[model samples]
Target: MAASWSELMLSKLVGRCNNFFQPGSSRAMCKPFMVGDQQVGWVWPGVEKHIQRFPDVFMVEDKQVSLCPSLQMYEERTARVQEVMVKLREEGEFIALKGWRDEMYEVFHQRSSPPVFRMERTATALLGVKQYGVHVNGYVEHPQKGPLMWIGRRAKNKSTYPGKLDQVTAGGFTAGLTAQEVLVKECAEEANIPQDIALTAQPAGAISYFYEDERGLFPEIQFVFDLKLPLDFQPVNTDGEVSEFYLWDMDKVKEQIAQPDFKPNCAMVVLDFLIRHGHIHPDQEPRYLQFLENLHKTLF
Candidate 1:
């Protein structure tokens, strides 16, 4: 029998979620990247061979990768790592480093503890380190139509996910910024939203997944936010990252996410929104429980 549209959508959403969490046998082949006895990330064989050249900076042995113990201080370690990263970047070694933004991300054993060192944001992925980001789900309560969400289309020129659908406002969490700081900055920079309006965005928890691709391993967490925008408000892209915005009803948003155009991670964020707001209920969706559980995988 042909599956109904609702059933098909649920199946697709679950499939997408499953894909993001599947690291497969690739993870077993990579070496755990460690610093001060704590594993901070993973080192792929290709990157591992290159870093092995810098013996003064890295120590790869015993089926694991670690920074040289002599580089003890945080600054010292970060500087040494940066030097190796620069050499790799100049050589155009990894595809992940090509779009380097000059932004940095901290390397931590866990989210609560202090970072051991920092590395270029792009390299974090190449090394299989977890990345963090903020995603805002902007919506309005229409007097007549109920709730409507604001979605963005990535600019065609974007280096990644060009012309794909994404959240209303999103930005990666860099080395020194807090989640709220990234949230407010992205709201204004991506959507031209003012600070006062952006401040009202409430914390909407987070979603995490461990996904791998040709670029590298992505064990990522996106801190989510919900912004209740005024009915008359419109989002204009200040940055070229986003090409356009759409005010979509819940059904429309659901339908589009089922297709391939929506960025995978962003689709998970929207699915989280729908589940939290009752747009998708346990009574109707057979995969409701599984979706809630798998969307927030424990990467560590």
Candidate 2:
């Protein structure tokens, strides 16, 4: 007999949970349980007895509720019951015949399978990797003289890009989201800029770059978008991810871009956008030459 949809879903969840509990375990050992025609993971300790007595109570409940409850009460009750089952399993007290039978029935009648992806911290890396992109905007004003294009130095505690200067508002594209989606999300998270502000800004085309860090573990294909902000726009860092922010004159930025410790790809992306937008002169003296040298090394 074929497994029911609920049974299949439950089995998959249990398999994932088991693997999570015991990382590097053999697949055969962690294979989901199969009981007769039903998958084993789908059968909670006393579920069979409840089914025999209640006769399709599980099925009678709204299918949507059974899958994902919109009601808070149903969710809370289901969580409490699952927690009890987990505790009983851990204590080995459920191995007794009566305890075992009761658990099976209680699980089938009271609990709903939880989502595999909902496990905490399990999704952090996935979330981070998914949010990768390039963002570009010109600070037409000089660092100190005009409205300096504020660049934030990353906090020393950061795992990536530690102590490096980054764009005023930048973000990487994430999975299931668009470039604009990422850019807007990033601005809010990194700079606390209102979503409304981001919506009104114009997109000035993207600068693409491939980068590999010294460790070679941090490889990225970045796409930077140019965003023009109002001269009066004042940015505040709501989060401590940035240690400090400083605005430099366009000339100051050109000098900073030539520094050896500066994050190469980020500086290149910013300069590329500025040069293309006519913010920086192509035939200027020392600053223009330095910019070209940096650009040449970064691109080639």
Candidate 3:
């Protein structure tokens, strides 16, 4: 087994994903995609034609790329792109939108008519665009031990990260609602937390990383939060997405993270929590700085 959480998990998550087409300077290389001089995304070298299938929206010339210059154009072109993604999903594309916020995510520099692609298909519409989500680490005041945390086991039927451990609450950033709004809503829906309690969740910070797979690139930013619960409160799973909940000692939580139990991305959220709360210190972990800095990366 690896000595640290970073080596066993975070490194593999970040290190194994460097195969994306790196959009270089004014000179495009490795499948460059330009949206008005901004390389907002990229595609693997041999995979450009799959993107080329949406000829009207994407222009690939000599492996260099360009997108529709106007929002109106993308609005007109999303249907065909979605059609392909849907077919791809049937062909085994692992797209998931379990707790999707029904708002339209703004796409491209022009801030177009907010593309109508399905939340799952949004990645397909643009291969390298980044998406955002919200994650919160909920804890309680223990008069004797100080603090303990609430954790969830994702439902086995979940399309992604099934049966894995997760933070108290998490949901993706949808087209509508501020992060706070989503946080409150998710707290109630996922954990049965009352609105009054949900409103107390504080904005801790954010963690960003890059991930690529058969579907495409996901350079994501997760806004993290910390909510302290009433001494007697225990989370009840209102949403079926979470199968069960547990209030575990910080030591137990850290132990589980070092295993393959927590959801992969959730592992980093937990690591961030440990560092911020002084549970994981530079004096204890050899590569604490590198691990912290690597989690917040700009992978273009």
Best by lDDT: 1
lDDT of 1 by residue, 68-162 (tens): 98999889999999999999999997898898989999888888988888999988977788899999999999999999999999999998889
Each model's TM-score? 0.94, 0.48, 0.81
In the range 1-300, model 3's lDDT, one tens digit per residue, is 336654665554445322232343211334656666666656655447565766666677885677655523454445554554555455543343223223455444332334333234255323555677889999987989877989999999886779999999998776666899989889988998998998888899898776665445666779999999998887888879999999998988877875677776787788789889998878768768877766687655
Q: For candidate 1, report its TM-score.
A: 0.94
Model 2, 1-300: lDDT tens per residue?
112322332232223212222344332222222212222232222332232232222221221112122223434544543443444445543222122322111111111342221111111121111113546453544344664566767778765668988787675443245667877877787776678877655665444222221211111335566555566666677767777777676656656654544555666666666576576664533355544433333211
lDDT of 3: 0.69
Model 3, runs deviating above 4 Å: 1-6, 9-30, 45-47, 70-74, 77-104, 108-126
Residue-pair clashes per prediction, in order, are 0, 22, 3
lDDT of each: 0.85, 0.44, 0.69
Better of 2 and 3 by TM-score: 3
Q: TM-score of the candidate numbered 3? A: 0.81
lDDT of 2 at 53: 34
lDDT of 1: 0.85
What ranges in model 1 sit over 4 Å off?
Answer: 1-25
